[model samples]
Target: MRPLAILGDNITTDHLSPSNAILASSAAGEYLTKMGVPEEDFNSYATHRGDHLTAQRATFANPKLFNEMVKENGQIKQGSLARIEPEGKVTRMWEAIETYMNRKQPLIVIAGADYGQGSSRDWAAKGVRLAGVEAIVAEGFERIHRTNLVGMGVLPLEFKPGVNRHSLALDGTELFDVVGEIKPGADLALVVTRQNGEKLDVAVTCRLDTADEVHVYQAGGVLQRFAQDFLAQ
Candidate 1:
């Protein structure tokens, strides 16, 4: 998987998918405008989440988003920004996500502590999964959000004790491979291959805590598993 974005600590589901008032310049707001919905009628992202077309655009759309992939004046800049790989082009987060979607690229998000801490918003996980993010490696994760990710078929891996994004010195420019089988609390290896032909393996723990969780992930998510079960009967 390719590094799609690098985030700092205490990133809430609100940050992943904001529920605040939609601004005219935001992706969701613009789409509403094109569809003839008046600017004032464009509700908060939380209200429109059932509509994937609009919700997907709001993933990581928080106004306070601080993607380390974006830098300014030789320092990491804050905001909804992303640096696309191979070309190393820095662009707006939504634009980069659109580019990756066009290329069918699978993405991995690297993050610091409390990776998903906030209100238990299912759309938070759904939005990223729709954005082509296949996995997330972080120092820690909220119990609810971790389950939410598994329910959405996104693998959640935790860094070994005391290890974090900073310890790895990741610049969000590496190709990552999650090697090994899926098992609750299993020791998985995250192999990072640098752009200059260097490699390192960091141990990560699979965050699936039970057999049911594993089954849900294997079936592609909670909804998919339920659908299959319903069909089987």
Candidate 2:
């Protein structure tokens, strides 16, 4: 996996999936319009989350998102923007996700402090997984969101004390290797190799804080585990 995007601190659940009024220019709104839903009928993302088609479009749909990859005239532009690595195309967040999905690429999101600090919602976890994100390495994580990620089978890792995205010098131009085994409260190594052959190992803590969380993650999320158990019985 590689760094899909580098995000800042305090990235809340709403940033991952906005629940406010949907605007015509928003991804969810545009998707609804294309599906023949009238402008006035388009609802908030929180309402249509049951429908994955419309909900997935809301991934990273936050208008206030500040993706470092998006640049204009040598300045970091705001909004739901993403920079596709290697090819280096700066485009809308969803478009970049679409490209990665089509390429069958795996993704890893690197974030700053208090990652996933807002409302507790599974869509925040589901949306990123649907985008093909395999894991996330952040400076820190909100407690519940960490569990939610595990429930969704999305690996949640944390940078060791005093370490962060900036300290790693990750510029979204590297391949990441999550090296080591999975265990509750385990310290893992995130091997990052840069484009110039520079490599470094960053120590990260596994966010599967409990044994049950580990089991759930191993079974590919809560529902999958339940299904497996049910079939066995």
Candidate closest to the true structure, highest lDDT: 1
lDDT of 2 by residue, 1-233 (tens): 86667898999999888888889887778888899999888867888978999889888888889876666886778898888988988888888899999999999999999999988988999999999998999889999988889888999999988898788767788899888889998999999999999889888999988899889999999999999999999
Candidate 1: residue 53 lDDT (0-100): 93
What stretches of model 2 exceed 4 Å from their correct place? Answer: none
Tens-digit lDDT track of model 1 for 1-233 = 88788999999998898999888898888888999999888878878978899998889888788898888897888777899998999987889999999999999999989988979998899999999998999989999999999999999999998898888889888999999999999999999999998999999999999989999999999999999899999
lDDT of 2 at 193: 90
| Model 1 alpha-carbon miss at residue 42, Å | 1.2
Q: Which residue pairs in candidate 2 collide?
A: none
RMSD of 2: 1.2
Assess the local accuracy of residue 56 in candidate 2 as a C-alpha lDDT between 0 and 100: 91
Q: What is the model-wide C-alpha lDDT for candidate 1?
A: 0.91
Candidate 1's C-alpha runs over 4 A off are: none
lDDT of 2: 0.88
Give the backbone clash total of model 1. Answer: 0
